[model samples]
Target: MNRISLPALFITLVLTALMSATSVLSQDSPSRVLRAGAYAADITPTTFPVESSGSMTRRTADKAHDPLHARCLVIDNGETQIAIVTCDSCMIPREIYDAAKEAASRITGIPTQHILCSATHTHTAASATPTFQSPAAENYVGFLTEQITQSIVRAHSQLEPARIGWAIGNNPRQVFNRRWFLRPGVSINDPFDRGSDRVRMNPPANSRDLLQPAGPVDPEVPVLAVQAIDGRPIAVWANYSLHYVGGVPADSLSADYFGQFARQIADLIDAGETEPPFVAAMTNGTSGDINNINFFEGGGHQQPFEQIRIVAGDVAASAQSAYQRVRFETWVPIKMRETEIELGVRRPDKDEIARAQKLIEDAAPGPWSDRRLIYANETLDLAKYPAAVKVKLQAIRIGDLGIVSSPCETFVETGLAIKQLSPLKPTFTIELANGYNGYLPTPGQHALGGYETWRCKSSYLSVDAEPKLRQTLLALLGEVAR
Candidate 1:
């Protein structure tokens, strides 16, 4: 009934058109909602007397001291999804991990590159890869592949609206640099008889000859936690630079401190029973040169598995302290990038091979009485490896937190350097991930010459491998951060 002016009509029409355009745009690209899911899939071998892979000599476990698991966590930001799995084993080969990832990708609609699988480096777990005298348990490998694949599938199926956060905790009392420099005149007693090593690995505790640690230990415990929209705990993923805590009884399969941490953290956070059970994973960080042993202060004797329990309790407490401070975010962008780089292998030459052959033929061999013989055999084995091998490296970004992974038992120095230089505010490294290349020692650490730098199946990467891998990882992190 009111008289409409020309200017009022024009303005009304313009406002209506603008509102319609905005509604169409909003409908086309809705706001992203973050969702997360987690599962702990049992990976314990069904058969007994399976070979264990972490020891220098062949060792078989007849029974399971504790169940092993493949802890899986899936995060989705509507536009992208990523799956991370940490298995309770010593180290898994690339072939097995590839098979698992391919199968998981097919079912979950996640790309193979979006999945990151790693080992917990538990010394007492079943063997899936041949290392030293232990041969790969074919049956267990097959079983493990299936289990890992299912872990991802089940985790994806459980996805629900969730909030996520991360924080860093410090626990320096547990980690120590195991490689040490001895006083003047003390022989290093290199297994290869090179007589070039200036430092010794795991020297006697409290020995007067001990001069100083050759490397530094990383004590930062980075934790990522996810919870339901209703404040129900979902999962906690924590990383530490200390290697496995080994005090398990012989002929028994255990997950070392890794499994203990999972159980204790659940209790510490009061993640009680739920329809979809809460999951926790403790992943191994850059710990090639770090261990629980404190050579400066000698440790007293303890019962079997006692050391593992003590270490797990202390670390879980540290994680809980950090978990309490996390500020949950309802939505965060997720990004992951993977790349492969070729690295030269420290293969033995003709002269080295001939010497190794001679040593094997001359030695009275019934289980290799001397450590030199073990290394002599390693030289011959290394000669058959390819001159160059490709190693996979990955970087992941969740909000302001960054995680980079290497397929090696990486040194703490490399992790520290990555954290310091990464564009993301807080960054951490996961070692022995995706595949098993070998131990990664920086050029400076390699110069000092310890067990980790010895040329063998366990430590065969070229001298420059660490620098190349570190740079590549930093570049990937930069890409994801952008």
Candidate 2:
């Protein structure tokens, strides 16, 4: 050392310092186990224009703005962090979500992949994407993004050393399948009817089509209970497969059934029966075909109050069962990964585009080509230009639990396939997470014509879909293990 050259000494010192800094940074990160904090803001508008139905006051739920609807959770080991933001509305555009992710990454030193932005898919909720048909919905996008981002930033500052545990229970009874292949003879005339079609087709979706359990169901309701060091619960993340929110009415701002579900958990925890001060939110699972407001059922898509209570009971029971099933909770390694896959698009031919343009300018605009409509306009543009097939996929493995988000409503059969190869003891698959891609059928389903079964609409994409999703999940698991 005494005889070392100046150049050699400088190089050795730089290498030593780099190694020391790397070790300290790694220790501060949540690569292995971490603590989390959560916060949500009620974004219901203070005032809004609306109408109502029998006994249902539009003003009861409708307000000045759409609910900012945020779920901010932190993934951290004290020093480093990442936060997840989910809203109750239509899909958040990938670009918008990415921007928020970038902002969070800059502050927390966590990669964009670690920041998740998901949606609750409430039809009553306003669209958060730009270009809304109604000014109200467009205003919602701006309002929601600001509030959600603020919530994420707030949640990080509120992080407390907490414990997290998960459990699962049955939830199929709350929702039923709305699609069925009408058997021969049943028709609009027949009560217990099943009808036959020449295309050998199903009724598509009849208000009267009875539920025919066509595939495997993951009825388990998974719940993650997050508690403070004082044993007070901060939040309970719940997941279920049903898709009905009985509270939804025109212009209303309620979070629907999920809200009720959350309140139930809060009450239980507040009573000191479980964990106090807990926030419970139910995440929507593969519900592309599930409906809770069954017009097909006795509810007739109308409120009975009794119907709300009944469904609430079902949700509560499922959530309770999940609460009882926490096997273990030693902060396990977590790997959060995202990949862009194609959902497929419907690009019109040169002639089709020309015809559409003429129709839009001259004739009455088609529902799919309305210039003033946000969704329709996007559809129109997609027809003029083919949409890229880049859907985002996420994989998060917490200890032995693997949770994957397939933004598209994954087919039951396809979900079964993923589970078959999953390495985690339990793999929770959530769809419509970031944005919606309609119903994601198998690559084979594209050949079999049907509404959700087919990818004819511009929103219906099919590129880099199935295989990319699988690879993304596997690759993520590998990364987390590292």
- Each model's lDDT comes to 0.94, 0.58
Error of 1 at 137 (Å): 0.9
Candidate 2 residue runs with Cα over 4 Å from true position: 1-33, 46-68, 78-80, 130-136, 184-216, 271-277, 293-309, 327-330, 342-344, 350-381, 453-458
What does candidate 2's lDDT look like per residue over 1-482, in tens digits?
Answer: 36998999999999999999999988775354457777776655434542221121112235422233677777675434555666665455666666666776676566777777777665555544422232224444556666666667767767666766777667666665544544445542211111222112223344344434343455667776776766667777777776555454454555666666666767755623442234566777766656664334444444633454567667877787677666445354555766765544655456645654555566454333332232334335657445555677777766666777877666555665666677775676776666655566555544433334422331355543666666676666556545
How much is 397 displaced in model 1, in angstroms? Answer: 0.6
Top candidate, metric TM-score? 1
TM-score of each: 0.98, 0.75
Estimate the Cα RMSD of every predicted model relative to the unseen true structure: 1.3, 8.3
Assess candidate 1 and give its lDDT.
0.94
- Model 1 steric clash pairs: none
